[model samples]
Target: MLYRLMKYVLLGPLLRLFWPAKVTGLENIPAEGGAILASNHLAVADSFFMPLRVPRRVTFPAKQEYFTEKGVKGTLKKWFFTGVGQFPIDRSGGSAAQAALDTAIRLVREGHLLGIYPEGTRSPDGRLYKGKTGVARIALEARAPVIPVAMVGTDKVNPIGSRMWRPRRLEIHFGKPLDFSRYEGLSGDRFVERSITDEIMYALMELSGQEYVDIYAAKAKELLAAEAAGARPAVPAQTSGARDAARLPESKAG
Candidate 1:
């Protein structure tokens, strides 16, 4: 299969040679059955290194545009992304978002390892952002365990705006699988979902040692941009969680 070929023969070996990733607590990955590998989003390369280090095929939902283009260039892109173990999902909100969530649920139910970024988007700064509850919903709906993963040093290798990857050491720390079995059959409860999401984010914060920010990463990006443009933007309502109180860092050029 293309996945195996790229992982073993084509891309994996080459990446390992250059980036030299070291993994800790890899035994935390289940040998079989469904589970969610929830990680903090730092840089684009988080997607590349995480999957290469894991034994099983890890699938992430990519923007639908990655797979929907036409012509030779589009065809090549579609092939490349598919070979690299990504599938298309509509990220637009409403029904389209629900449909993507449904697809994620179905993947886990079918005994696949679903790689998800609970933060929804990469951190604009290096701080951990508030997680979206989608990961909790998937775990509850599929009745699967959530394994918190922290990818370290990737932001240095592929910084926020860099098109090229630098040779830097990578570390993947896998935390113990979090069981939400007590919340079984409570998938639709928003409060329960938020609680689970917060727990996951706290674990990530501990593992990666990144400062926690209460605002969503996308919103943080908007604020950073607004500040860059010399505009005073309205600060969003902040969450009251313990980690949420961690002050947002001053914006810097990436």
Candidate 2:
């Protein structure tokens, strides 16, 4: 199949030759079974390098834009993402968001390795942001363990605005599998989900050595963009009290 061809024959060799990984804790990955690999998104290359180093096939729910763009470049991008076994999901909230979560849960239940960025998107300033609860929801629904993964120095290889990837040494750290079986059957409980998400984010923060920010990555990006446009950035809401968890919507773009 195309996935094997890319991983074994085509793209794998090329990636290993250029951006070799200094991987640790790979043995943490279960030999066979469903699990969620929750990682902090630094660069787009995090998607490429992590899966290349892992032994099992990993599927990620990518933004639908990757598959819907028009023209030849878009065509090739669609082919590459599909060949690597990624599924496209709409990031737009509402029913689309639920559908995305459903797809992820179904995949996990079918015993597939699912890669998810718990922060919902790449960090805007290299700090770990608050995680969306969808990851916890999926893990609880599928009764799967969640592994915290960290990718270091990926931003240098694929800088935010650069199109070309420069060769750089990479480090991948896999933490111990986190089991939430204690909260079984509480997938939709908002407070429970928030607690689970915070635990996962804390694990990632410790593993990645990134400063933890109480705000979401998407909101950080919005503020950064506003500042760049010479406009007043919207004030970030307080996240200290219990009201913070209660106010967060169930889903976000991940």
Candidate 3:
């Protein structure tokens, strides 16, 4: 009830006015069945816009931070996320991945649309980075078809550091459903996970036209962090007269 109310009353109108998204190949979505909508994350608004375009109620795992807050603002935030059919997932690895996998399997078993960002996090530079194997693990474990979804121009409206949202044209293109049943018997195998993840990323690359990186999200995070650190300005050397005098005396003694 809350999901429907939020979709139709609050979010729907706001998105229509601000983002004005246009959806294509929505017919590719199964009319009634369990399926995974694997999307590339370009902006935070990707969550709201994708769900709004899909006819069926699609639920994604959102970070728990959105729900943990104090007072009226926290309450509203929690309510909004709940109304949108999102459940919380710890972004941290280890046991949190297991919990997320369990939730996704349950949703698929119940014949609901499970939305996931294969890239794990929003692309920091709008380029489609490599997808995490968790998405493949869920699809194979749940025996659900993976539908590749491409989102364009969302990053332009609300980018990484922007406080305000600009009205822009958003496009959502859903590719054909990809069946991974042939590998169903090989669940929990690392090879199968990597293969399936690669296939999903290939489809997304074709759809979104973003350069594909062949590394996982965790590794990508490390690389990006290292790059950011490397980009920082180097500290200047001290050139005080005392230091110069000491260096000159030490050199003379040597």
Query: TM per model?
Result: 0.92, 0.89, 0.86
Candidate 3 residue pairs in clash (backbone atoms < 3 Å): none
Model 1 C-alpha lDDT per residue in residues 11-112, reported as the tens digit of each score: 999999999978998899999889999999889999889999888999999999999899999998898899989999987879999999999999999999
Which candidate would rank higher by lDDT, 2 or 3?
A: 2
How many residue pairs clash per model? 0, 0, 0
The ten-residue window of minimal lDDT in model 2 covers: 245-254
**Deviating ranges (above 4 Å) for candidate 1:** 233-254
lDDT of 2 by residue, 1-254 (tens): 98999999999999999998899999999999999999999999898899999999999989899999899999998999987879999977799999999999999999999999998899877777889999999999999999999999998899898899999899999999998887887879987888788878878877988877788889889888898898967435433422344234233311
Q: RMSD per prediction, one decimal?
A: 6.3, 5.0, 14.4
Q: What is the lDDT of candidate 1?
A: 0.86
Give per-residue CA lDDT, model 3, range 1-254, as digits (tens).
Answer: 99999899988989989888778899999999899999999888888999898999999999897888779999999998999989988868888879878999889878999999988888776666667788888888889999999999989998888999889988999999988887767778876676677678778887887766555555556666777789533222222322222233224324
Report the number of the highest-TM-score candidate: 1
| Pairs of colliding residues, candidate 1 | none
Model 3 alpha-carbon drift over 4 Å, by segment: 221-225, 228-254
lDDT of 3: 0.81
| TM-score, structure 1 vs. true | 0.92
Quote model 3's TM-score: 0.86
190 Cα displacement, candidate 1 (Å)? 0.8
Give the Å error, residue 132, model 1.
0.3
